[model samples]
Structure formats: structure tokens, C-alpha cells
Target: MIKLRPQPLRGRPTVSVVVPCYNYGRFLPDCVSGVLGQEEVEVDVVIVDDASPDGSSVVARRLAAADQRVRLIAHETNRGHIATYNEGLAVAEGEFVVLLSADDLLSPGSLARSVALLQAHPEVGMVYGFSPTFADRPPTPRTTARSWSIWPGLEWIEQMCRRMSNPVSTPEVVMRGSLMREFVGYDKRLPHAADLLLWLRAATRGPIGRINGADQAFYRKHGANMHVEMFAGVYTDIAERRRTFDILFDEDSACFPDGHQLREVALRSLAREALVTMCQAEKLGQVGDEPHDKLVALAAEMCPPERDPRLWRAYERTQTRSRSGRGPVVPRTVGRAMADLGGRIRWRRWRRTGLMSAVGSL
Candidate 1:
């Protein structure tokens, strides 16, 4: 167990915003400025250049020279993102820490808002705000009813498990430095979903807080995004999710004593994702057979034996639509008919089981 750092005395606590850059030299200044521009807060900015060929080190050094609070750590050799994060954490000295990517920008007052929430609620380990994902153009501002909301740790974890998707973007997140120090930096074995895992881990420790508007952060959707690579079949999202579940189970067995429920939730989530991916593939008719086969195989492994028939039926319908060039879109009447058919099938299944498995088997 790692020792927890003492909380700072009453006043504005320092925030260490670490910007890890690989080949994002052009966006480094914008990212650094976003951190420095935070309203009413003391921020220590650490810009880590991971031996980028694009002279990111030069930009980092310039930023450091311009501000006393800003510092640069340029790697002689290119270390992976995980290594750079750990290096930054090792050097960071702040009550709250944020690992902002060099390519992303934090919205105005984001740091102050996040810090205020953490200060108000000492029980929360991590706080994140809404981030609008955009490509090429900047996102327009949006309003919200409340500035922020608080969620109990376990409640937040349950919500994440149910959604099976990461709603918290990296730039919008602020973590308690002490809690972050408890664990080693991002897991190398699960690079694709390391941030998700970290958020879940933090949630296990305490409650989570969220600033409730898209104006908190701006997530740039470009070709270089790690998630885009994962979606393009460069890395296995399914396997990464599975590994994440296993890690969480091992770390917090007390929270999930059986592991059966968690496995089911994960499988169901994967099945849902697979269906969406299949729909996209069918609509485009461009995905290769190998990738599609892998998706099917993985889904089949997780799907319950009794629900296999339903899975096959859905697959056949999607394939038929794809080949017929009817596309993935369904007419209103056809959609209503399909929904009625599904209801009847679900009813029959429930009658046979003598219990309502509304949450159908994956």
C-alpha cells in the first residue's frame, strides 16, 4: 500500500497539470496555455516531451522559459505514453493532478471548478467534467443547470459497468494526488483502456464528482488519437476490456466476491458493442472478414448458450441487409414490426424460464 500524502491547509491547493507530448508539438502551446489560464488557482505545469521527431522539446523548453510555474522534461529516447505519465507523476507536486494530453485543451475555469468540488467534498477521489469531442472545428459552448454533481464511488462504478463505455475524457479529469500515488501509473499491459481502469480504481477508493457541462474540456478527434487506432483494429478493445475486468476483480474482490455478476455485465457490454460494430460494418460493407470473424468469435465465447440462437438470428439479419445493399437503416414500420417480434420472443423465453430476464443473456 502506498502512503497517502497529507491534504493541504485551507486555501487554494496547487494543481500539477502534466502535458505528455509525443508528436503534438503544434498543439503544445494551446494545451499549456489552457492550463496556465485556469481561473483563480495555482497550477504547476509539467510538459513532458517523449523524444518526438517534431521538435516538441523546443516548444516545451520555450513554454518553461516563459513561466516560472512551467517546467519541461524532454526524454532522450522515446518512451511510451505510460512511461511518460509515470515520470510526470514522480516529479509532480500538487494536491490535485491532471494528465492533460498535448493535443487536448481544457475549457476556461475547468481547473478551478474541479478543484473547488474536490475541496468541498474531501470524500471524492476523482472529479471529471463533460468533454465535447470534435474533429477539425472547435465545439460550441453549452449551458448546464448545475455546475457540478457528486456520485458515490460504488454508485459511479456501477454506472460505468452498466454503460460499458468511458464517458470521462482525459482532459476533463482531475485526480486526487494522494490516491493517484497509491497506484503505479497507467498499466502498460492495458494501454488502450488504462485511463478507464484508473478512473474505476479511483472510484473504488472514494466518490467521484462531475462538472455537468460540455464546456469543461475539448477533446480533439484526429487521426493520431489512440482510441481511433484501437477502433481501427490496431489494438483489441475486447481483450483490453476483459483484462480491465480481471484487474478490477483481483484488486477489489470484496466489492465483487463472486466475479460472476461482473463477468456477465462485461459480456453483455461486449455483445452490445459488437452489435454496434457489426451494424457499422454492414452499413459500409468495407470491414474485412478476419476482423468480423474475430468479433463474432469473441462474442460467441461470452454469450450464454441459451441466447446463442438469438445472436445468430441478429447476425443473419445484419448480413442479409449488408449483402442486399438495403443498408443498416430500417423503415419505421419494419422497425416497429421487429420490435413486436422481439417482444414476443422475449415473452416466450421469460415464460419458459418462469422469470423475467429483461436483461437478456449476452
Candidate 2:
């Protein structure tokens, strides 16, 4: 399955967007609309409905009715996240495929730009773009990177040994679907984090490319953000993620420092998992206890001198400070209460109206 260049293909390489939907009835339409609104390409949409309790299937079917390119695959019973994506990937016949989560929305021209980037750069195997977040409340802006590049070819098993600069947003990717089939599909072992591991595996095999263009997708940060609802699953995700990397660069491999670095990463992940679990359980005071001390010592033994964590990093929100190092003043009780109520009302209204299509520009 050669990935025919969109530039040289008889027509634009057919780009398929695999939208996996569960109970995201409210955001489904806008998510579908955002992709439908792209420019200059043959777009095929695959809407995989995971037996939504809500009427998400109705919305997806309606879109399929109106557009021939839109196809709906309704499951009889709900399969987990990774399986749903596997189902989508199984049926995809496009040169490039975009994995669009149901709760998210794509920016206009996202697929077009991603396909064009891969098309223009012959050596690039997979190409991705950036995403702006549209959480239920406004999302904080991410620190934009200076550039995006991953050795750009399968020949980078060497470069990946040196730099692991993978900053891909899956929703913003239009990757070579043909090449994607070469590897095992999403590991059911690590459902949600499977994509991140898949990308890492790609890095080990070759190079991934990024289109340094405008924001290409919108990640909705509502109360139902997939990761937010599954905090308990984080450690397991990290473990599986590390195992995936370890398989590629375990000791005895020619990839220098790669095997060593990855093993250290696995140990670090384990320590981080312990710290995070303790933090979530509000057992911060026990950081020097049995499990904690054990993880810390193992981390010291496994990691390079500079990489060891003597004390775990605690995640705590901090107040914004001025140039004088003074934090912003809090309003009086009455004002604070009133502002909270007002915010609740406004967000409820916004949620009711339903943010259709994460708008292209901001």
C-alpha cells in the first residue's frame, strides 16, 4: 500500500477523518462540521458511534445522509476507546487518516494543510499540525514551540536516538494510513494513551513531520475531557507507554544511549506514577514513606545523576504575581460569590447553545 503523493495522485489523496464518538451528543455536530469545512481536498469522514446513550448516532447519521462522503459505523455494544479507533482504522481506505475524537472540533483547512505538507515533502511519512483548546471554560494557551520536525523519514532510527521531539496533536494529523497499518493497531493494553505510544513507535521506525501552519484543530476542554475523567488510569497508561518504548530500544540494540535512556524513562514513569497517585489521594505528607522512599531510591539508581528527583514535583496552582512579586488581591466575600454565580450561569448558557464547530480563527 504505497502512500501515493497527494500532489501526484490522480486527484488529491483521499483523506479520511476517523471520528470516535461516545456520549458526546452535544459536540458531535460541530466536530463533524469542522472537518467538513476544510479546503482543497477529497475528504471522507468515518463516524464510529460507540453506542452513545445520548442521541449522538442521530446527529452522525443525519450528516451521513446529507453527505455521501460521510459514513457512519454504529456499534451494537460499546467497545472501549482503542477498539473503536481500531474499527475505524480497519475500514479506512484513504491515503491519510485523521483521528478526530467526538468531543473535539477541527479547524478549517486542517486536513488540507496536513495532506499538502506531506505531499510537498516527499520524505515525510506522517504529518501533523497544531490545535487550539476550547474547553468548557476557556482553556489556557499552550506555550507554542519554535518548530515541529521528526527526522521526516523511516531512516531516522538514528536521529530519534538523540532527540525525542514529538509534539503531535492526533486530531491535527493527516498521516499515511498505509504505513500506519504496518505496525500493530492501538494496544488495548493502554486505551487512551495508545496514540502517544503509536507516535513513539513511529519515531523509532522513522521520522514524523509537522506542518508549521496556523492552528489546525480545536480540543474541547469540557468537563468530559477524556483524560480528565480517567485520572486513575494515568499510571497504567504510563506503564504501557514505557513498555512500548522499551520494546523498541531495549538493551542489546545498536541504538546507543537509546536503550539506556528509555530504561531510565521507564523507571522515571514508575516514580512519577507513585507521586501522582499519592498526590491524588492527598497523601502528600507520606512522600517519605515506604512506597515513596522505595521509588525515590530506585529512581536514583536507574536515572543519570542530573535526572534523579530527590523530591517529587508537587502540582499546585499558583497565583499570578506582579513585577513587585505581589499576588493579585482577592475580592470581598460578597463580590466573589456573585462572580461565581454569574460565571456558572454564563457557562451553562454557552453549554446549552452548544459550541458548534470550534471556530477556525480563535
Q: What's the TM-score of every candidate structure?
A: 0.81, 0.66
Q: TM-score of model 2 relative to the true fold?
A: 0.66
Q: Which ranges in model 1 have alpha carbons more than 4 Å from their true place?
A: 1-10, 140-145, 223-231, 284-290, 307-313, 316-362
Write the residue-wise lDDT of candidate 1 on 296-318 in tens digits: 76777767436656666766777
Q: Looking at model 1, which ten-residue stretch has the lowest summed lDDT?
A: 353-362
Instruction: Give the least accurate 10-residue stretch of model 2, judged by summed lDDT.
Output: 353-362
Give the runs in model 2 whose Cα sits over 4 Å from its true position.
1-11, 136-166, 224-237, 250-262, 265-362
lDDT, candidate 2, at 44? 83
Best by TM-score: 1
Relative to the true structure, how large is the alpha-carbon lDDT of every model?
Answer: 0.72, 0.58
